[model samples]
Target: MSKALLVIDVQNEYFTGKLPIFNRDASLKNILKAIEYANTNGIKVILIKHIIPSPEAPVFAVHSYGAEIKQEVAEQPHNLIIEKHLPGSFTGTPLEEWLRSNQIDTLTICGYMTHMCCDTTSRQAVHLGFKVEFLSDATGTLDLSNKAGTIDANTLHETILIVQASRFADVLTTEAWCQL
Candidate 1:
């Protein structure tokens, strides 16, 4: 299957900004490794950036440092870069057209906030008739607490992985994906 690596939201917002990702160091390492592998091979690499339109936004404000992709990820070789305003990368973005035009039938997902953008993107990819492989260790999230309940980073991350593996995508680690 023709493949493309979707590196989503590896932005400064998850590092120096308000939202700090859990296990970021390890996640970033794996993401970089995946990108390197994708580049070395013929797999297309696409970088996804998240931006909040409002300047007063708490995170990922447009033209803000937080909205910019992290240096390590930004420097990596990629075929294209897409900026998304919502949780799903395909929402209001040209991701689907680009994927189709490139004949990318298999999408390998990596990058930040496993439960949010990663999960949404994976499901969206499946719905659009594309096979999705989610990188377990290469995606991350921080502890979250809402009016409903609280969940630790590990729990939140694992829960998403389980759900993804259930149907939406093939959940696997970066090393395992590299070996494929």
Candidate 2:
């Protein structure tokens, strides 16, 4: 089976502006290692970029910066970039077709917002019949409020890891992922 590394939403917006609690350096290091490993081993690497609508405008307005993938993880020449508008990378995107065309059956995922984009994409990949290995430490998220109440960023991060481990994907640390 062909395997690929899916690097999701490692953008400047998450690192600098509004939601900025991300561990930029460490996540970059981990993703770089994974990228290098994939390059050396001939494993395909797909980079998923989330393009959220601009604030206070139409829900479909795409900001230029929000559409950019962070420089740190954008180094690979062979990497394929998939722009997504929804939380799930596969939603309304060519991700499934790309994976099919490339014959990718296993996906090693690492990127931003553990409880949102990353979580949604990982679960969607699983549902689409791909084996998913989620790099836990390489994904980060911010706090969110809902009817259940507010959840802190750190707690939400850990909760997603726990939830994904049980039902969605195999949650592995960067070290463990590298070993695979």
Candidate 3:
């Protein structure tokens, strides 16, 4: 299968910034490993950065360090770096056109905020008829306590993976995906 790796929102905002991700170190390591593997092979690597358009935004303001890709990921040799405004990478971005131009039918996704950007991208990929391989351990989410009740980070991460596996994507650990 023709494949590409989408590393979504691996930004300082989710790591060392305001919204720190759960298991930040572990997930960062896994994403780095995935990028290395993808680079060593023939797969294209696309890194998506989340940017808040408003200068007065609370976080991820454009030109802020928080909106930039983490140092480790930035040092990697990626094929493309796309800036997105929403949770889904495809929404209001050139991601779809680039994927089609590159003949990418399979997408292996890894990065921060599993319940947000990662999950949205996975579901969008399925809708676009692309096979998705979602790296469970390489994605992360924070604990939440909102109107919809509360859950810990681990539960939220696992639930997103389960939901993706049920229809949207094939959920696998970094090691498992690297094996393939």
Q: Rate the local accuracy (lDDT) of all candidates.
A: 0.95, 0.81, 0.93
Relative to the true structure, candidate 2 reaches a TM of: 0.89
Question: Candidate 1 or 3, higher lDDT?
Answer: 1
lDDT of 1 by residue, 19-64 (tens): 8899999999999999999999999999999998999999999999
Model 2 CA deviation exceeding 4 Å by range: 53-63, 146-148
Give the worst 10-residue stretch by lDDT in candidate 1: 13-22
lDDT of 2 by residue, 10-115 (tens): 8777776566745667777888888888888889988888766665532223665645677767867556888887889999999899899988999888888888
TM-scores of all predicted structures: 0.99, 0.89, 0.98
Query: Among these predicted structures, which one has the highest TM-score?
Result: 1
Error of 1 at 63 (Å): 0.6
Q: Arrange candidates by TM-score, descending.
A: 1, 3, 2
Ranking by lDDT: 1, 3, 2
| Regions more than 4 Å wrong, model 3 | none
Estimate candidate 1's alpha-carbon lDDT, on a 0 to 1 scale. Answer: 0.95
Tens digits of lDDT, candidate 3, 1-180? 799999999999887787979999999999999999999998999999999998778899989988989998999999999999999999999999999999999999999799999999998999999999999999999998899899999999999999999988999999999999
